[model samples]
Target: MSIRRRLGTTLVASASAAVSLLSAGQALADDFSYNPPGTLVSGSGSGRFDETIYAPGMRFPIEEAPAFLNSQVWGHGGGSGPGGSQCDVENFSYPWWDNYCETRSWDMPLCPSGQGHQGQDIRAKSCEKNVHWVVAAEAGSVTNIGSYSVYITAADGTRYDYLHMGSVQVSVGQDVEKGQHIGKVSNEFGGTPTTVHMHFNLRQNVAGVGNVYVPPYLSLVTSYQALIGPPVEPAVGSLDEVSCDAIRGWTQSPSSPEAPIDVRLYFDGGPDTAIGHPFLADLSREDLCTAIGSCEHAFQVPPPLSLYDGVDHVVHATASDGSSNAPEVANSPMTMNCAFELPSGVRRRVADLDSANAWHFSPFWDEIAVSDGILSTIDEGEDLDRTPRLVATSSAPETLYLVDGGWRRAVSDEIVGVAWQFHPMGAEIISDEELAALPAGKPLRARPIVLRSASGDLWLVDDAPGPGSTGPGGLGGSGDDGDGATPDGDGDDVSGSCDCVVGRAPASSAWTTVFAAFVAAGVARRRLARGRRGTRP
Candidate 1:
């Protein structure tokens, strides 16, 4: 047997060898119930009850269901004390158990006693070994392989360890996708066999602490729910209205009708598609109060500027109750046809003179102003598009500016890189004179687009990059159809891990380098508007 597995079984089994696993209480599969975190079998020691889902959108490791997630050593199996066959019917049943912090001697800071089992042990559908397959829980590259262990490390540095498996199909340094098969479950612990099961571990760096193992039961439960449909119906609500001004809605859980629920609004697609955000349904509504005995069940937020582009933008509102199943509000998927047109013949371009680039926008360009205050005779420049791409200046490469409605608004690197892709070296060098002449408007702020990760958590992602590409002379330069923006509304600033500072330019369009999948960090709100257009320096 593996050194850790043998140590774990000895510690946990000897402590509770006389206690039947059934004594923990019977949990039905339908209820998806389980003992609360830290509620281990008697003598197994306490477990970590931390509820944070460190891994969102992870895939269930088992390739198929009928597999049971219960204690291997403490169950009615042939190990320390109980002499029942490991294939007993009770061994392959639900609800799942939390053995992450079961009794052990390993160094585990997250555990209550500072040392315990580092992961959860799961039994396959039956007692047969080397038949049930185990797959990758998240997309990552295989970093290590042992005689009976495999480790995959994600791009973000989170490591996933799978042990006690046979027929290994992956080698060290091989990239694997979530749900991809790695090997079959077996009792292969070096040269000795322990029990027919798979042991899984999650390791990542935590602030104020070094790399360590975290609780994985909650993440496994979420992913398992995704694998099998939710047992209960999702919360219900209504998308009361979707107007040119604001989108309003109300949501309530049948399980708890009087409590206000959270809702998410998606544009042009379901929860998995397009841009969306979450709004609290805690606003008061007399109609809802009369119907459900709760007044604080309404949600209302102004329509995003992206949806007012003279087209049908479908907005769907669904309850966000941290469940796999997401039920849309009644009258959902309503269309928001708020048309905001851009002025025709507006000249928008990055005027380049030497290494300096100036982003200039005007309703009508009567003439061109080049170096030395010379009004040079130039042909008609290109017109600005509806949604202008974000840009930066050579002088201030760290800051990205959004030009819209005849105004230039400073955008943070968070929005420029992670939320929406922009050229790192996309800043155009403009003369100081031209830069001072451009007017600054309100910061280009908009509501964050909420995205659901593998762990079933809703994260606020910023908007996607706009319609145009950057060129040799900066944005809208030669060989690319550069665009500009118009219109505005209120939204929270985004936060992310990618810095996206100006550096080497990629050999693609301006908005080609997408820096996606970052958690939203709320930036301090800036003043409503900055310097006005044409305001003399």
Candidate 2:
């Protein structure tokens, strides 16, 4: 069957969005946040949509109370920053743009010059989809529900657009109030899912100009501040082991990356030490992933960083607890960081589809290849039983996803989209003509392969082209940089300071909402928060 046919009904069929909008008297003061507690601004999606496709939208003057109150909608994640390749139009065709872009570029034809990323991308507390709520930022009427997005029109005629939802709760003409549950967070992007993030945008109908992008960062920050009060200490419970190439650690707290924005190591109490960002390390480590929902983290340094050059270096960690002035978690190195026995290359397989825990792939059934960063025909006689061997290492083409061919990927016996879903060895994507051209026994290519976001996971895609904004642990903003994310907020807030809205929200109740599980990553649907929660990867 076609990929869409296989996945259409798989996800989001049961998300609680089926509940209709409240009949009347919708409250106006939605002082509370719509996103669950601990949500972050991971990708910080650009509003480049207006910059590239539509006319310029109105910009909110951050300091103005009216704008702040009007733009009080919140995003889903905890991290934010200037990520490399946030607007990766290179892999795809022309005109289409991602949600966020700070350093604007419009040189490409059919694209405007000054328009940058307009909206910000928020992440649910975890990468797992569906668990997070896509609540209405303000009381508004649902105007449009396209395959890829949900457009809610606010009282002022401004539009708050939410993208990539697993399931849309509100329908056209339904009225919604701020913090009203509208949909669930998801990887749904029409057909092409772009990572697990909620792409939020604020559009204004400028009389002569159509709906345009109004910078929503300040309002988002204010909303985030209102939702999550003062920053608390990062929950860095313990250090596992340290090595030259990677620093392994865990947190007793709720760690997906477990608290702390950036984990820094001060070598020898000296001025310059190595800063190793974290990622999902060794998925086979069941104990950690089970107890902490995959809290295992590692900072793998690239070759050029001389910091790991052998001499004994004392190391301690300084972590930011997603707050402005929280005390840093000072943890001394439990063990020296080393690169010994590390894979040095990223290798994802049908097995990484190890969700649901029903069936698992044997190590031999899986394999790693030096992709040479381009698409290639699978080895002629390969099967699940054979170890994966690199057939294309010298080519410099970009890394590509194989056609969706796995029956096992659909845990619920439903197909999500085809992108990134693993197919068996023989069914490479090829044209019908190319299929005829192939040797009698060779497999034929059938569909388009998608690109995996480039995080700093050196194991599988270290050599893959396009070091994208999706950083290690899939949290956007490769923390390996000096300062992870600049506010890119409105007015003075754009500077290093995370300007708090003073008393917009009460400090006593720190995190307001409590989230449970995520939506299906591929199919774009999620179980109801009331249903059996899926284990987040």
Candidate 3:
């Protein structure tokens, strides 16, 4: 028999849906960040929307640590110095900018404008030129060389260009491995030095667009993350239960999955203050086998006697395998209000709503109020498992619902596929009548906002903005001199920083009405505060 499929709806169904959903006043801390595609420096043209990572697994162009991916023309020590030396610490910091279409007169079909700058500019380890080594992003051969450019052509007809180098390492037609030394980053603009940075470009045969310069900023960011590894402590686990009897949780590092990591508990204070000795998370958990691809990563420890006082206390957990600043597991910083007088039976029920007990509900789930008095009078009638569980009807097996806390929330494809990383195979099959008995809760929503301003700032505004907050601005430079002309020497149609005429155009207002709707929803108060900055060229 054919069964009807029921799926969870996404919060980000459309731009309008996103605005309405985000306007609901549900706030969360920023966990991920990225500049939206086409959000370029003001006066620079609209960026291309091609999200192709042409050179997947490609090495970061720079061959050292702490490389800054800012614009050369608008960055410090360039045409528009942000009032500091090139070696300023802020210049080396992150939230990198995209300069591919940053104002130039080149035939770039992919850019919103038919003509624009053709490549991305990357700053080396420091302000100095010809010191940091530039490596081959992909395994390819040096096809051609110019006074200030070296081109590597992969077997797939994908061209990788490296510009403005001091010591040219590889010769033309020479085979080189990925990450092989190609040259040193410099400011050799065919004799006249422009800026001490590397101009990198990616050219490939796009199906519809033909041979054109694709966006490399996203690709570079991906490869760079692979090179440097995840931020500080990238632990992937969660704190499951906390009670007067004992505290329970699990943790594992993606970097080292096979080995068990240590989980430390802190009370009242943050990670700096540990209440008791660290507990080794080596116990096996059946659910973890599918959730995290590992089993022996569970931990259960008794609450310290000192926490038995009537006052409520907050507890946090951090995983450690040697790295400093180990990240806190999910559902952490849970609150404990257990007193010695509370019966052991009631303690378990209080722990079942552990997250609700501390207002630490997952961003996917809405907050529910559960008071101490409510927990003390709990009568153990039916033996129901309060832990999160997946349920589906045999009549409509495809439709999955997350049964938790006497309520059922439909699980969407995105929720199961990405947000919570839940495996649908673990869902418990039940009769349709049984599934209808549970009370319905609000639809689950994954937190993360992708907001585009009237100005060309496409922000991934994750966290809640303060009263006077502002979106992360562009290069915030006053100059319009973006890699003015193509330096002489390269036979190909490549471009870089040079002494040439530059022009500026007014900022595009086509998106103003669309952006206004978001502001009206009060989801983008930060964008409304700041006036439009630069015009597109």
Best by lDDT: 1
User: Residue 282's C-alpha lDDT in candidate 1?
Assistant: 66
lDDT of 2 by residue, 257-352 (tens): 542233444445421223233221221234554655653332221111223223455655544233222122435554342211111122332223
Per-residue lDDT of candidate 3, residues 244-288 (tens digit): 445678889787897777787778866433332465677666777
lDDT of model number 2: 0.34
**Per-residue lDDT tens digits of candidate 1, residues 1-537?**
432344344333432422323332233345555566666766567878877776655777998765677677777673542557565556666667788888777789898899988888887655556777999987788999999899998766788999999889999989887788999988888887577799999999986678999888887877777676545656888987786545777888776777666797887776543433655576666677788777767776556644444567788998865554457889998987753221111123322321011222111111111221111111223432334455554454445565554455545333333223333344455543454445654443322222222332222222222322221123332212122222122122112221221222222221221111111112211111111122335
Two-way lDDT contest, 1 vs 3, winner: 1
Off by over 4 Å in 1: 1-31, 230-537
Q: After superposition, how far is residue 131 of candidate 1 from its true place, in Å?
A: 1.3
lDDT of 2 at 365: 14
Q: Judging by TM-score against the true structure, name the best candidate.
A: 1
Model 2: CA > 4 A from native: 1-100, 103-113, 206-210, 230-537
* Clashes per candidate (backbone, < 3 Å): 18, 58, 2
